[model samples]
Target: MTDDPAATFARARAAAGVLFFNDNDQIMLVDPSYKDYRDVPGGYLERGETPRQAAEREVAEELGIHPELGRLLVADWAPSEAEGDKVLFLFDGGTLTKDHLDGIRLDPGELVGFQFHDIAHVHDLTISRLARRLVHAHAAHLDGSTRYLEHGEWI
Candidate 1:
């Protein structure tokens, strides 16, 4: 039997991020220095890395804080026009204690700024698909369960 690399290769790209909240029920979002839209702290997964690992690592690289990420909040399948097919993962970053905030040291070259906002502002602050994804993720976090989404819609 012969193994075909074409059939075994990854068809979709994967990325992971974390959803952090505050006591007042706000979502933390970051403004990337290179992108126009605001987004959560994360990046694409490295080879052989799991989603959870990627989330934890990305947060540390971008925010300069090593937060304990919990179970996944959502795994979304979103295909972008520019990126083709992709699978996005979101993990629970839990509520930020004062220490978490105090520890933040944004990488100026990658992230310009970051802020917390009411859930309602997600639509206005992020890209359309990500806005939907975050809205669902925030809700899932409050409910203590993970969500399965397709381009941000509950599936």
Candidate 2:
């Protein structure tokens, strides 16, 4: 993908990510059979659903738990090869226990494995930049610190 920020943002589509946080403060990542790497549980937002509502529905469908999402942690405009002009919304999912995870039911076509990973290690994984920003914003929120908001940064 081109790193030209303007071009990328101009083509970004609308999407959402379900920010799943565990009791240990880690976020949940899903490994899809189609991709070698894992990513946050989410997909393109359906018509008539808000980002927050989409996040809640996605987590419940993928992991079978209704998560209490926090205020918007990260919102970014990104571009994708398969789908362009992707606007990603990432929310802070509160703590979840093993009991909660046990309720998850994987969607065979989209997900294969799942894990609760540390926020710091998130950058090391081969994930979308939007995902990284979401995790960073989440970590910042958790530490009670301020973070720069890149509103319309590329648009």
Runs off by more than 4 Å, candidate 1: 1-10
Worst 10 residues of 1 by lDDT: 1-10
lDDT of each: 0.92, 0.69
lDDT of 2 by residue, 1-155 (tens): 77776764464456666666777777778888787877877777788888888888887776667757777666775555666556777776667766777777898877888888787787676465645565566665687542443432322
Give me the displacement of residue 4 in model 2, in angstroms: 27
Q: TM-scores of the models, in the given order?
A: 0.93, 0.76
Off by over 4 Å in 2: 1-12, 128-131, 144-155
